[model samples]
Target chain A: AQSVAQPEDQVNVAEGNPLTVKCTYSVSGNPYLFWYVQYPNRGLQFLLKYITGDNLVKGSYGFEAEFNKSQTSFHLKKPSALVSDSALYFCAVRAFSITGGGNKLTFGTGTQLKVEL
Target chain B: GAGVSQSPSNKVTEKGKDVELRCDPISGHTALYWYRQSLGQGLEFLIYFQGNSAPDKSGLPSDRFSAERTGGSVSTLTIQRTQQEDSAVYLCASSSSAGTYYEQYFGPGTRLTVT
Candidate 1:
């Protein structure tokens, strides 16, 4: 079984300030982590993913996330927040049981980010 | 190319009625997925399709829920005997390949309301 937890329901940040949205996971094997963002009346957009190699992964819209194996966490981050970044963020995980991406993906409850100008 | 698309962006049906939601994945994407988002359940994987075949349907909530993909292009999710608990946004996503690192592009979801 695989699951992800986004402890924070909402995170408010001022423009130009750094922001972080924390996520943690539990999986039967090595995990594949992903971050997706959703805007009003829109589908989730892929942000970034942590497959292997570097612990820090950069994604779309200047967003980045760090994969901490020891902490069992993958937290999304941005050096400077923008009002446009306000949206619902979800963290997902997939157990590396297969080489195919068709494996089921377990998602967190989601975190709402409100970036103020 | 266009991204994934869904028809009937919003649907309202009386309890016990059946409803069908359609999804058109991105062109040439071989892997398609269905997920449900609701206030109570949050987000959950419903099923996955690789081309026209569905290797696993265990994620589906119950017998009332079923899906089919044809021609490796479009897919439809059917819900029978809808209940208020069935109200949620149904999302569809597709990926170019089944590779572990492949990203699943999503489509704007269908908002289902059971009255």
Candidate 2:
């Protein structure tokens, strides 16, 4: 089984300040991690993913995330925040499999980020 | 090209009623997924369909929830005998499973309110 944990329910950050949303995972074999953002009355938008190779993955809207294998964590980060960036963020994990049998992802409870001016 | 699309932007049904949700995945995408997002339980995977293979229903919470992907393009999620607890936003997504592409593009989602 695979599962993801987002420790914070809400993170408040001021505009132009850096922000971080933490996520951790537990899965058999390796894991494929993803970040998504949901705005008001909108569906989830793909942010970024950690497949292999680099630990630092940059995504849309000037957001990035760092994958730490040792800590089993993939935390979303942004160097400078914008008030428009306020939204609900989710972290998901798909267990790695060579045969491609695992198609579904286990998602975290989600964390709400409130970026204030 | 168009991204994933879902029908019935919002729905309100009485308890014990049945409802069906529709999803049209991106053209040529071989993998489709269904998920539910509620206030209490953030987001939960419900089902998955990949090409001609059988669907993965392990994530479904109960037998009342079922889905089908027809001809590998469009899909439908049916919730039978709905209860108040079933209220949530049903989301649909699609991705190209060929090669190393694993990003799942999502649809706008259908908000279901069971009263």
Candidate 3:
């Protein structure tokens, strides 16, 4: 079974500083990793995904994630944090296989990121 | 372009009562999904529907939980004899297709409170 693990329950970062939200995964085959952000009372917004190629994937709002196969990790990063960036972050993973049988994503417990000014 | 929409942004019901949650996917989307978010459960996949085929209902938790998509555009999730444990945010999402390459767009979610 494919699963995602987000070790941090919450992360605190000062405004304008770089921020990192950790995520790791366990899967049998190649992993399709994704990062999503959700603000209060809003739906989750897709940040980026690692399908193929490029170990470092860049996404919206100056966010990016590094996909490390050896470490089995896909950690979300931002060069500079903004107060508005405070939200709940989720990491998800799915395995690549025939029949696309695993369309259902296994999501992590989620991390609450607080970017303080 | 309007994104996926869910009706009754918030619903409060008593235990043992029944409730229905609706989702309107993107105009041309062929795949729809329902998920539940509880305090500790994270996101639990409830069901998945692809095109006109039989839905993948493997994720549903109990027989009391059922869902259907009509005209391949809108979907409804009904829970019979709701329990307090069923109180959570129910989210609806839709993708252009069930392929791995397609991204799923989520709705704001309906916050269900069973008291």
Candidate of highest lDDT: 3
**Candidate 1 C-alpha error for residue B33, in Å:** 0.6
For candidate 1 chain A, which ten residues in a row score worst on lDDT? A96-105
**What is the TM-score of each predicted model, taking all chains together?**
0.96, 0.96, 0.98
- Residues A13-47 of candidate 3 have per-residue lDDT tens digits of 99999999999999988898889899999988888
Across residues B1-115, which tens digit of lDDT does each residue of candidate 1 receive?
A: 7999998899999999999999999999998899999984668889988864545788899999999998888999999999999999999999997666678899999999999
Task: Tell me the lDDT of model 1 at A11.
Answer: 100
| Top TM-score prediction, candidate number | 3
lDDT, model 1:
0.91
Off by over 4 Å in 1: A98-102
Q: How far out, in Å, is residue A6 in model 1?
A: 0.5
Q: Candidate 2 clashing pairs?
A: none
Query: B92, model 1: CA deviation in Å?
Result: 0.5
- Candidate 2 wrong stretches, greater than 4 Å: B98-101
